[model samples]
Target chain A: MADALLETRALTAGYGEMQVLRDISLAVQPAEIVAIVGSNGAGKTTLLRAISRLIPCGGEVTFDGKSVSHATADEVFGSGLVQVPEGRQLFDRMSVEENLRMGAYRRGDRRAIDDDLDRMYTLFPRLSDRRRQLAGSMSGGEQQMCAMARALMARPRLMMVDEMSLGLAPVIVDQLLETMTAIRKEGVTVLLVEQDVHAALSVADRGYVMETGEIVREGSARELESDPEVQRAYLGEV
Target chain B: MELLAQVLVGGVLLGGLYALMALGLALVWGVLNIVNLSHGALIMLGAYATYYLFTGTGLDPFAALPITAIVLFVIGWLIQRGILNLVIRGPMFNTLLITFGIEVILTYLAQLLFSADFRAINPPYAGNNFRVLGITIPLMQVLAFAIAIGLTVAMWLFLLHTRVGRGIRAASQNLVAARLYGVNPRSIYALTFGIGSALAGVAGGLYGTVSQINPYIGGPLTAKSFAIAIIGGLENPLGVIVGGLVLGIVESLTALYAGSTYRDVASFGVLILVLILRPTGLLGRTT
Candidate 1:
């Protein structure tokens, strides 16, 4: 309860004429890794977009005691709720370095930004070699890494990453998950939405299973993993 | 040989000026996906602004560039905020219609205010020419070309390096990501249109120094700008240089070999060929 940094209560959002997310309520605690696991069209991505204010949403969204119900996407990020959107939407024409710089697009602390740049290069050394290359020229794995690094540059308190493991090698996924663990270690809360149920539960502190625009089950990651129904439905362990 | 060199030089200079003319339109086209039909009319207004600044205040045309740019920037900002913003999210055809209407209105306003008479900005250095490497270059033309190229480079650097510039570039790709970066869309949209207009103002001012301007010149100028933008690719600001130089040299050679009357035919012919061949433009991305 003390760590509840972000809370969405009875949130409802959808596209024109059709509702994708219905009465969704979720909360992320300080420095915790919360994973939302679901299949395609389960409204996991919609939940994140609703929280980030990308689409029109109803119900109250609060981040660190501030209301963001009517806030713009920029204001949400400004309030320290940043999202790495689904698919690596990297600025294709911009250089890798420039893309990373854009991550701090709202920050005014010049000295801290330079320090973060060094830290990013250190974490993902592969990016250092391709710093001058256009982001579009990078492989999927590299672009994913760049996207994460760019989001990190925002220095957000709560980082929401969508489809992090999509179109990447297993090794890259493991590496990225490991990086996420390290980021969580830095005391930044993370909300990860993924379709890979096994990998997501394996890494998350807690997990929520979404089905058809509703949270069917939510508990500690270990409890959810051990739950017979989840094992049968998601992990195919029947 | 000297005549050939002179034509090449003149063509390159003219191309630089042409690039400046197209730069603003290309910017609005690339970012907002709005093919601003009124872009040339904005340029026409810029030329008049520069003209009046010179005639009324005795300010040097080149020196009045900042003023002209500011004035045009405000005009563009208002147009976007007042008019374009309302229908920005609407269909592309509607946007085209609206911009065409803007073009007509601007043309009529310029005609009413400045009259239908042709005007030129003839500073003291307008008639001066210098020989560079055995080829003669008009000083005014040289200055215009230099400033044009300089501004393009500056724009490229700004979009590449600066925060607002990067935000604009990011917004161009996906407004969602840009918004995640704290970009206020309405204001940023206004700012982008303003910057585009500012660039047009500088180009118009430069054009005034080298050519005759009247209310009716906007349509042809707008057509030429489209050709350059299509040829140059909108991916990078520097692409305009390639587009401008190609059109400039082609027009220059056409005027030399074919006849001055055939310049428009050659320009439009190349444009059509490029459209038929590489629709994404030479420098634009294939995908």
Candidate 2:
């Protein structure tokens, strides 16, 4: 198995001519939860977008020992590198269950899909009862859970989540985080982008702090959490 | 009361054929996001194809359906890959314009070839009818309705169950996510357009059996198809049936009570009301 489930070497991507992600390099090892922390507009979402091939990018992105730099978003998805996009971009018109089914659009195995759906319901019991409800009608927290569960339905080897804690109550965020940790335990490598430094670092094994489209600092989560500079700058502490 | 019931039954039967006529246009619009102004023209062509097959080759129109579908599929595929794909990435208006252009070209060509003469496919069984509950139903109309509903169901199943169907749905929902599903956007797009065209062709073939068709019919049929798609909502295939039935009944009742000239006005008025009051459509969720 490749040491890094996903790696970006000198990755640069942007919308049109304005580069939002400069020459950047990062790696996510198998079975590790890596967190990227940055302020708003720090290119955290842009990085995920580039990695998932949603935007035109120039750089080497390799997944499972294969170069993904030239791969289309569908090709990247087919290779098992799935992303739960920001703002929970579920098909609002579809039922929650239908949205979940759409996540597994690439899979041909109906039996496995049923099994995974059952597992998703077990992980988010609230979703089970509301499966028939329109995804747009669900509460913000429930929508987030549905988004995460939908991504899981794809059976991805590496799952990228952008801003899981955004617009959620603290208790719901905690529950989501716990569910994410459980997902990682199932051997899926997770690369999380978050503005919540403390919450992210608590679950992450390693952390990278980004600023102005570049990684400004990297350390073990524990080290970064304790670093006075990081605490003062990113964690909102003196 | 009996007269009203009989009229309603007739309207429903006619509605079934209307649903079939609109099905292909609806599929193309809903899945491919192409309004396909040429849709009715393509249906006209399908009817012509069936007409020639029956008259020239002595083949049953039903038996020749596969051939018509395949030929139309190829034509649709070429149009998508050649003309449609060029503007597929551009504005929605571009598609509308190009398709309208195609419709004009096809209508002119059809007129030149078919001589602007109205044609209908009348088989040996054309006059047969079956009566139920004192309401008489034409066999052809019943068959057309059955086939229309059947095709709609099949389309729904294909989208839900088949790989290509899922790919088309994926492309419609999120192009980026669709790529992740390993579907080449260009080919999938062409394939979707082709399928839509094939459906249009099938609807056209069935239409020839029940009604007179000419190149001029394309305009009104196109308008009706658009109304059906809009009223039904583009999100689900079954929406077309509901939209078709509503339109069919309204048109029938208007023709009977308000004078035949008011039918078009009523259909257009209902369309306007739906647009102003519920743009997402009757079945679609309001955004």
Candidate 3:
């Protein structure tokens, strides 16, 4: 088996006194696309947040062989684990290009950044056309594209995307899934949290089923797709 | 017509100084999201540093600028690291209160050390003036104005071209992503505040050559800096310069036509109107 790029061992976290994640353990292999599917408030987003060190967490979160559980959010990011948060979170007043440039803020590789930017522009040609436009003015789908591209600009070893399909139209969602598959093919590992079970499983190499903040089941995407329990509970069919 | 031209030139020159005065406040507000009430006190400290240097060692105020900036930078760094950092991650109101407390402490300390005597730095060429286009302008005012604009431009260039400047800007935009860049926010916060205070100090030193300094001057200077920052917007560095010039011209026209006492009233009234009508100053895009 390929080495895990990221590993979470019995991880637990929550806001204030409310425990949201209860001993959730997971791992992502290098260059693999892993998807976590769950109902709303099942601690999927919270899990990503904890792994990124945005919130205080417990147990072990190791990225690239470094302990990230006690690390600050910024430290976690410095270790090449980047998160495209639930909301687009683009700086609304900034131009689209400026927002993308901000993603490479920690990096000094100007040549590489420029190359990545050109690649992003090619991936989302609409963004290239509206490069100078304010991010807030863009349509929802356009903003999502910008957010994903911005995260890519970081040249992350592991990218965590939360609710990539949220509030997006079906067509846009399909396009985004295609982009995610393409990104995975580029040798970048991805950890995707999604409500769109069918769409997620279609592109995901492996799938984890989460319920009430715990990983209830894990298997190959094909296995989970045909599982009776997954069909009844998440696929909305018997 | 000559009087109008003279006032216009004077207003423009004064506006440059005003821009320098507001630059630090705008930087602190823009980057650190801290409205430093003690900003004027740092400016006051800069003036005192210049005054003492000139009186003791006879160094020219302009030449002594770097010294004042360094001293003020140290002071700002210590304040941020020791006092301000504790409450920085808390509510905005906490920051305001802590900075206000700092203002009071600095003011009382200045009063004890410097006294309330109004002081000015008079170099050998202090009384010199030159006529340009039939309008008389002081040599010191021209020099101060040039230095002010020069420093402001340099600051803009630094932020745009340098890695550290980008880090500061990134931190202002998103703290988490800024950290991903390997920027220790605690140090960045201190460095930004230090740079802001250093700018204030330079402004204060230049101001001493052009105006009077007392412990009481800090309050009004703070108010003027705040007005300039709001009028300029927090997003762009160049906006402060435009905001300063606008206020300077307005104050000059109001003082000439209305009265001297109406200067603050006019400047602050315009600030209020701008906030009400368009809160994001000229260069700032509404968020």
> Which stretches of candidate 1 lie above 4 Å from their native place?
A1-3, B132-135
Candidate 3 share of real interface contacts: 0.35
lDDT of 1 at A81: 91
Chain A only: list TM-scores of all candidates.
Answer: 0.98, 0.98, 0.97
Superior candidate under DockQ, 1 versus 3: 1
lDDT by residue (B1-287, candidate 1, tens digit) is 88899999999999999999999999898888899999999999999999999989999999999999999999999999999999999999999999999999999999999999999999877899888889888999899999999999999888877888888888887777778778888998899999999999889999999999999888888899999999988868888899999999999999999999999999999999999999989887521
Inter-residue clash pairs, candidate 2: A74-B179, A74-B180
TM-score of each: 0.96, 0.92, 0.94
Please tell me how candidate 2 rates in CAPRI terms. Answer: acceptable
lDDT of 3 by residue, B1-287 (tens): 99988888889999999999999999999888889998888999999998898898989889999999999999999999999999888899999999988889899999999998999999989999998888899999999999999999999888766768867877887676556435678988999999999999999999999998987777788889999999889878888899889999999999999988899999999889988987777666443
* Selected candidate, larger lDDT, 1 vs 2: 1
Can you write out model 1's per-residue Cα lDDT over A1-238, one digit (the tens) per residue? Answer: 5458999889999999899888888889999999999899999999998998889998888899888999888889888898999987888878899889989988999999999999999999999999999898899999999999999999999999999999889999999999999999999889999999988888899999999999989999999999999998889998
- Candidate number achieving the greatest TM-score relative to the actual structure: 1
DockQ for every prediction shown? 0.57, 0.36, 0.37
- Report lDDT (Cα) of residue A78, candidate 3: 71
The positional error of residue B178 in candidate 2, measured at the CA in angstroms, is: 4.6
User: Per-residue lDDT for B184 in model 2?
Assistant: 76
Q: What is the DockQ of candidate 3?
A: 0.37
Badly placed stretches (over 4 Å) of model 2 are: B1-6, B132-135, B160-170, B173-188, B257-262
Stronger candidate by DockQ (2 vs 3): 3
